[model samples]
Target: MDRRDYLARLAGVAGVGLAGCVTLPGSRVTGDDLPSVRNATTSNTSSPRPDGRLPRRGEVTLPVSRREMRSPLTRDHIPAIVDPVFGDDWDGLSLPDDSRAESTTLPGDAPVIGLTDGDRARAYPLRILDWHEIVNDTFGGPIAVTYCVLCGSSVVVDRVVGGSTTTFGVSGYLWRSDLVLYDRATESLWSQLLATAINGPLTGTELTIRPSSLTTWGAWSAEHPETDVLLPPPQSNTIRGREATFDYFIPKYRRDSPSVIGFGTDSNGLHPRSLVLGVAHGDAARAYPFETIRREGVVDDDVGGLPVVVTVAPGNTLVAYERRVERQTLHFSADGPSRLSAGATRWQRSTGAGVSGPQATHDLTRANDHPPMFWLGWSGFYPETSVYGEDAN
Candidate 1:
């Protein structure tokens, strides 16, 4: 079917008209209710896998199979920013002056993804990420900070390949609607949500994930007053043009939207846009949905065998910490909106440090691997993932 007929069958908008949006643990999407899978025959250009497939435009995809790869765009369609410049005031930065460019300042509620190492702390605004998916920087070390507009997943990982560091670019390929990136050094395809090279020489090698957080600008700024914010991409003067995204809050799961591509959701169940703190340890992965966290305020659970405590803070920011300190597991409860405690020791919700009592000096280690993500993206990657509040899992 062509685009119009395919779209017309899919609720005539962007997404399927299903009520439930989740899959049970260990379930695969083989139902007839799902949308038809498009045929993708992209070659692995630049660097062939030596196993026949070449990853170029409309050629073939590797190990992932051409059946699932969706090429709505070609490589580098949304250029990744390199040699990024940072400023102290996030609120002060403005989009490039253009009729199609963003004209407003960064929203106080806009979500940013970043990390604090020793004396340096930084936050990359999500609006900027909406335009450019990858930011290759030497912050702390060689790292690629990535966010998928469709998946709502922000991942930071060392960009070192074969003991040498390299930058990454958008491949314009979506593996199940997740961002597919390629290293400048190899042009090998990598999955943003899986954090693995799906094809090429380093195909099976895993990328080391750096700890990061996704929260609102107002909340992040208040916690780290000395934080530096990334400047918006310079306005394009040539064929390239700069554009602005007003919001990341997906209103509906349109087929055109990243969240709903090739999938179906229930009309009354959890929305595909529902955000969750995605946690993975080794091979085991789990999702702590925001809907459950907001109601309980604190979710004490284990993922990949690590004891995790997920809490909903002010501004709807979510923080996860390893509940065990000095080998002793602390049963945590919400002391207030943003504070958690175990007996007399109160933990700083912002930093995961104990603030009072005998073990005040000890700290609950923060889990940087947890990235706040939307359900459709997280569940698609880890169908065996056990949700926090779900009984079936």
Candidate 2:
């Protein structure tokens, strides 16, 4: 199935709806009445399978997902919460670059942060950033902020945009627990899934911190002397309460094939509501809502880590086998089995399903000896397949 058709099928359900506005939980309510699937409390799955699916070697252990439970915060709670904030323009923002030699050092020459090219850089602290690597911090005005509580260093990215020079830090909404501060960018709070902390009610002095990562929170408290860090408050509503479970399986169901999992919700009886399946891989991160889906109790490794990527269509229960391509790489061919050929210097696609239709115009090339890469020759059935690679290389 093609991407457009695959999406149409996934969107067929009567109750489910896309989150149009990037508002927090309360502001926008989806119409879909998808039942809840209370399978697990978090994204951790384990089974005694012979197959090596989990992050660890043993079948009994699965990698925990990098997601956190989120509840809508009261207006009073949000005022002082230290979270990262974002700006609209990409160019105006100050981002880290190669010049950060002393500032971006790790514990043991680990190269925690590195410059990608002209402006962008990647920072990763061995243990500290791993536990709390990806966070959303807010920037106050003019200063771009990127602080690692674990590493105890925050860098201001130097960027020039719209005739104005700017700097940025970890956005408040980066899903980190700390309240990020920022300036001059006008907008509403955008939502993040699988974030470390969802900024909630702000009126009090108490900080709602989780038990697992006390050190991370402690560092945050030390840095912000002027602000108060709040702990996770008691859940007044069942919708926001945290629960735990072991195993959950969505009744072997199929609505549309080639539908990748979109955003999930607390709708299903499982811990995570349901998997949001879409056609084709584009904006895979933004395509599905991690917070909403973790509620349904799927295999922990499957849900938490989002390990497997399969292609299937409605009425067909089994997911089609496909290879994982980074992003932006394309392959086209008139002869040979349709598959994704990787490791090439340039993106050259070769492979057609040998099917006749406008959809057959796309190419696929198998770079391996396993199974021949096949493209379901209809857009209506499967579109969630990964057509475009990440960088388009």
- Indicate the residue-level lDDT of 326 in model 1: 75
Positional deviation of residue 56's Cα in model 2 after best superposition, in angstroms:
39
Q: Which ten residues in a row are the worst by lDDT in model 1? A: 16-25
Candidate achieving the largest lDDT? 1
Candidate 2 per-residue lDDT, tens place, 1-393, comes to 433543344334211222111123234434342223233243222342466443331111222222321222222222211232222111232223422223321222221221122222222221222222232222222222233221122233322324454322233221212223222232112111111111211111111111111122222222222322211112010112321110101111121222224522212211112223322322232122222223321111122223332221111111221232343332322122222222332222211122443333433332211111112111112233333121221
Off-target runs (Cα >4 Å) in candidate 1 are 1-62, 90-104, 235-268, 281-284
Off by over 4 Å in 2: 1-111, 118-163, 169-181, 184-393
- Residue 233 lDDT (model 1): 51
lDDT per residue for candidate 1 within 121-157, as digits (tens), equals 9998776676677888888788988988666789998
Q: Kindly give the stretch of ten consecutive residues in candidate 2 with the minimal lDDT sum.
A: 243-252
The TM-score of candidate 1 is 0.76
Q: In model 1, what is the error at residue 46, expressed in angstroms?
A: 14
